[model samples]
Target: MKEKHEIGALILRVVLGLIFIGHGTQKFQGGIENIAGWFDSIGLPGFLAYIVASLEVVGGIALILGLATRVVGGLFVLLLLGAIIKVQLAVGFIGGYAYDLALLTISLFLLMNGSKLYSLDKLLFKAKNN
Candidate 1:
């Protein structure tokens, strides 16, 4: 049971990390400009869109390596919260809330649990246990 839990957590971590990275990559590639323009169209400050994009990209990379997992996860949680508020809240549950919910849940989990075995944090912290 313990092993299964660990495996499940690790899987969630990896998948979530990958998704974050992809989001970040899209922003890094200038997709955020388009997104920002959209935000502007919708009465939001275009700059905020870029800020969210940058945070997503940076936080995503950190999550992927399990480096500063708690911090990154927390940041992601904030980002997702903003996303939910700015976009999903009015769009209804089926529109964009689902993905944000998933990401937010996983990020909160990571913030609470941190990384697992085979993570940079594990490697760095392991010596203190022995």
Candidate 2:
């Protein structure tokens, strides 16, 4: 059971990491100016586009490497929350919010559980069972 649980976490982490990385790359390739313009159109600070993009890229890498899982997951949750509020909410549930909600739930799970097996967190922060 424990092994299965760890494997599940590993799968979830990698999938989520890849998804975030892809989204981040899209934001970049789509042009920061365009994204910032979209952000401004949505009544958000344009500068935030850059910040969010950087976070997604860096956080995605952290997730993929299983480094600082709790921290990265927490940040991802916050980011998703912002997306839900600023964009997904306007799109309505079936339109888009459901996806952000799912991502938020997954991020929350990772935040609470941290990395399991096959993670740098496990290797570097192994508990000393004295």
Candidate 3:
């Protein structure tokens, strides 16, 4: 049923959002500068650490609320892809890219489906149509 699918999406969105929030919080707790330094060591611009951290936190909230879900999901897909390719590729799948791959798939699903019900996007869309 359509409602079942909507519920499924909601569950996925909330869980994924929580995961991202935890990761972003961890980055902050561990020191963004340290993350930046690590990024630099990995051949990424150190400044990107701030951007990535911000996105993870802010985007996680957006996802939980289902605000601009597609956009946030799109960004997450790119972010995960970059992590998999740039950082985890050499480490192999079992403990390396596996998590990232899972996250990427969830993001891709959200990107494609957006949000249907019990979401800010749905509320706003309905309001606009009324």
Best by lDDT: 3
Model 1 / residue 63 / CA error / Å: 1.5
What TM-score does each of the candidates earn?
A: 0.84, 0.93, 0.96
| TM-score of predicted structure 1 | 0.84
Model 3 lDDT, residue 20, Cα: 95
What's the CA error at residue 74 for candidate 3, in Å?
Answer: 0.3
TM-score of 2: 0.93
Query: What's model 2's overall lDDT?
Result: 0.88
lDDT of 1 by residue, 86-123 (tens): 77988888866997998899999988987665677777
lDDT (10s digit) by residue, model 2, range 1-130: 8888888888889888998998888999999899999999989999999999988888898898898888999999999999999888988999889999998998998999876667887777778312
The CA lDDT of each predicted structure is 0.80, 0.88, 0.93
Q: Compared with the true structure, what per-residue lDDT tens digits does model 3 show for residues 8-124?
A: 999999989999999998899999999999999999999999999999999999999989999999999999999999989899999899999999999999999977667888787
Residue-level lDDT for 39 in candidate 1: 84
Ranking by TM-score: 3, 2, 1
Q: Which candidate number would show the highest TM-score if scored against the true structure?
A: 3
Clashes in predicted model 3: 0
Between prediction 2 and prediction 3, the one with superior lDDT is 3
